[model samples]
Target: DARVTQTPRHKVTEMGQEVTMRCQPILGHNTVFWYRQTMMQGLELLAYFRNRAPLDDSGMPKDRFSAEMPDATLATLKIQPSEPRDSAVYFCASGLVRSAQREETQYFGPGTRLLVL
Candidate 1:
C-alpha cells in the first residue's frame, strides 16, 4: 500500500520494566528518527536511521536503550530496565529523501508515552 497504516501507538509502564516500541512505516520512505520529550530537555533526538540501517544513536543510553531496523518497513526501539529519568513521550518520525531538494520534514507517530515510576 502507498499509505501509512497501523503504526505503533503510545505506551505506559512502571519503572525497571522493559519497553519495546515499533514503527510501521510509510511506503517509500527510507529514514526514521526517534525522539523523546520531557519537561527538562524538551525534545531530544534518540536515534536516526536510514535505508533500514541504524546510522547513529548517540543520544540514547547504551546500557538501556537500543534502536534497530530489522527490515525496510519496520523500525524498533527497545529500553531495558527503564528508569525514572527515561520517562517521556517518545516519538517516531519518518521522511523521504529527494535528490533535488533538501530533506523533507518528518511527521511524528502517535508517540509512546512512558512513565517509569
Candidate 2:
C-alpha cells in the first residue's frame, strides 16, 4: 500500500516565521508537484519536477518559496518569513509523468494547512 503523506496537517505561525512542509509520495513515482490553494489563487500550481530536475516553477513566488527533492522518497516545500496572505493549503503530489508531453495523472497528498498572523 503506497500513498502520499504530508506533515503538520495544520500550522499557525507569526508573520515572519519560517515554515517547512514535508511530503512523501508513493514509491516508484518519478515526478512531483506542488500546489497552493487559497481564496485568491484558487488552485495554483507552485512548482513541478521530474526525476529531481525542476521542469517549471513559474507559478511560484520565487522570493520566499522553495521546493526540492532530497531523494526519491522525500520532497519538501519551505516558506520563509511567511505572511498572512500566505495562509492557505499547500499540497504535494507525485506522478509518473516525465514531461508535459505525457499525460500522467498526479496523486495529491493530504496537504499542509498553514495560517499566518
Candidate 3:
C-alpha cells in the first residue's frame, strides 16, 4: 500500500529558531504538495512540485520559508527565523497526476504540528 510519512510529528521552538519538517512521498507519485493550516487561514497550499520539480511556492513567505524535493521520495520544508505567527500544522500530500480528462486525488500525511514560542 502507498502511504505518506512525516517525521518529528510535533515540534516546539523559540522565536527566531529554525524549524525543519520532512516527508516521504509514496513511491511512484509524481506530484507532491506542502500545505499550512491555521485558525485564520483554514488551509493553504504553500507549495507543490511535479516530477520532483517545484511548480509554485507563491503562497509561502519567500524569505523565511522554503520547500524542496531532494529526490523522488523525499520532500522537505524549512523555516528560518521562525516566528510565533508561523506556528501551524504543516502537511505533505502526494498524488498521481492524471490527464486533463481525469481527476487526481491527493493523500495527505499526518501533519507536523509546530509551536513557536
TM-score of each: 0.88, 0.93, 0.95
Taking the tens digit of each residue's C-alpha lDDT, what string does model 1 give over 23-76?
A: 866768888889998999999999989898888888988999998989888888
What's the true lDDT of residue 20 in model 3? Answer: 92
Worst 10 residues of 3 by lDDT: 96-105
Give the TM-score (vs. native) of candidate 3: 0.95
Cα lDDT tens digits, model 3, 38-105, are 99999999999999999999999999999989999899999998999998999999999967747888
lDDT of each: 0.81, 0.91, 0.94
- List model 2 lDDT by residue over 66-117, tens digit each: 9999998898999997999999999999988655566778999999999999
Clash tally, candidates in order: 0, 0, 0
- Which regions of candidate 3 are displaced past 4 Å? none
Residue pairs with colliding backbones in model 2 are: none
Error of 3 at 29 (Å): 0.2
Give me the runs in candidate 2 sitting further than 4 Å from their true place. Answer: 98-101
Against the true structure, candidate 1 reaches a TM-score of: 0.88
